[model samples]
Target: MLTEELLTLAAAAGAAVATAAGTDAWEGLRARLGHWFGRGDGRRGEAALAELDGSAAELLEGGTPTGGELERCGAAWRDRVVATLERLDGPDRDEAAHDLRRLLAEEPTAPKIHSGDQHVQGDIRVHAEQGSLAAALINGNVHFSPPPPPVRPEG
Candidate 1:
């Protein structure tokens, strides 16, 4: 089963990347994930967010994750985050690293899976930037289909 700390790391990584990427892509990805999780303006998205937020208290033990898992999660997060970074190429990779360092100074929120018995074997949090970096690194199966465009409220 997945540990808690790893999941939190992924979340922090994603959040850092997203924050570095800026709010537009981050928000867009958030909306996309909302659709994938069937959370379009519903409690589902809220739940999903709740599920992926908190602290990593008891994850990251045992031997390092398998090679396949690391590739999967890393690819997913790298795909979205790297793409966005490339598009918004104001800061270089080194800058992104600096941003990540700043994020580490703050306590990051942990990803809370609903069921404990059903272990998460891979990264499933849609975008690699959503939950645990380990999940992205380990390829936990937490992702689903992308969400539709978010509807804006009228003034």
Candidate 2:
């Protein structure tokens, strides 16, 4: 049985696979995932690559995908990852999990904004609705001051 941590990691890997499709990171992620799944078998590696390519092609077929489609794709890959992990045993499973962790850590991820520790590496947009306020502090401080009063015209 897979531990909670391993399950979480597999789910994340699945999501990463789905998210990386069609992006600049796609090729690297695909190659790494294929290599991992291949497990030193050339034919298996080629087959895995082909499967990944098909997934990518399907994902990118109609331009941007709907949220439902993306979720479906993610779920499918998540199941595949879980199945792969479940098939291994003992030291093999441990080593495969380690490799998966390494793969995830090495791959580039989209910009993330977290409380007290925001690290953005790509374009970020900050928009405020009417009568609202918005702020995005990349690496700077912000100061707020009252607007100057309108000057009255001399008679």
Candidate 3:
């Protein structure tokens, strides 16, 4: 479980970023935080963690101009993330995983949208049944690109 303070800060940070810079920036911020707090990383620090948490909370709640617009906002947010991770060690760092999970869960979830077509519905059903693929999609890794197969050499 995550502490109330931490969850509040994380949620606020996410909301603030999205509100200020649009959803693209918010998703990037989440990914960076997730990477930092993930358990597998070997790096550790204390001051960095505290600073990040503090700065994030402040930014989320602060009513400043968020000057330099997107650039400053992005830099400030990134700096806090780096600083906070710099302060953690061992157990504290490990515990960041739970914090991140809770923070990520705070992002508003959207119901999976399905196409009305039968083929699309079938594809969704099939992919949703695959654990790994489903997890990736659920985590927002679903991307748009050319469909696989049927390639031809160009002159």
Candidate 4:
């Protein structure tokens, strides 16, 4: 049972694994993550590295794991991270979380599009119908309705 913070960090680790897939940052991030999870054990690091590679491969097997696929990937990574966190203590856990955050910070989360109120990501080609929804350009090409106007309260 991981704390909420650790769980969130785990999710970040998962997202980093997915977002960095097929990019140059993948290898470095993977190595760093493996070493961190390994916690000074070469064999442990290698095992973690193998698991990371497998996760990335599985997520990208069909296509860019977007939507549900992406969610699953993130969940899977979170579980692995949680398991690792459970086995660690004090400095080890802190260091692991810090390392995971560093990896996440170094990797940018591709791009996202909003569907109604949802933030969706990846190389999605939006074909939004119904009025000017297709005119929203985020990060230069993608489009959405700017997440709807903020509601104002009584004056």
Q: Which candidate's lDDT is highest?
A: 2
lDDT of each: 0.36, 0.68, 0.39, 0.64
Candidate 3 structure quality by residue, lDDT tens digits, 19-116: 33323334444455545544455353343344444444445453433433323444455345444544666677446634654454344421121222
Candidate 1 lDDT by residue in tens digits, 1-155? 22343343444445332232222233444444434333234786675344322110011122233334334434444344344334434445445434433444332221222332323332334434556553334435445643222122222
- Using alpha carbons, what is the TM-score of model 1? 0.25
Worst 10 residues of 2 by lDDT: 146-155
Where model 2 places Cα greater than 4 Å from the true spot, the runs are 110-155
Candidate 2 lDDT over 1-155, as tens digits, reads: 88756766666676666677777687898999999989999898899899887877787677676555655666677778889999999899999988887887777742222222334332233446688997855566544543222122222
lDDT value, candidate 3, whole model:
0.39
Residue range 9-117, candidate 4, lDDT tens digits:
6656676666666565677778878888777899999998898888777776665455667667666776788888898889978877777766655555533322223
Global lDDT of model 1: 0.36
Please, what is the TM-score per model?
Answer: 0.25, 0.69, 0.31, 0.64
Q: Model 3, residue 49: what's the lDDT?
A: 46
Better of 3 and 4 by TM-score: 4
Q: Assess the local accuracy of residue 133 in candidate 2 as a C-alpha lDDT between 0 and 100.
A: 96
Residue 98 CA displacement from its true place in model 1, Å: 4.4
Cα lDDT for residue 78, candidate 1: 39
C-alpha RMSD (angstroms) for model 3: 16.8
Worst 10 residues of 1 by lDDT: 53-62
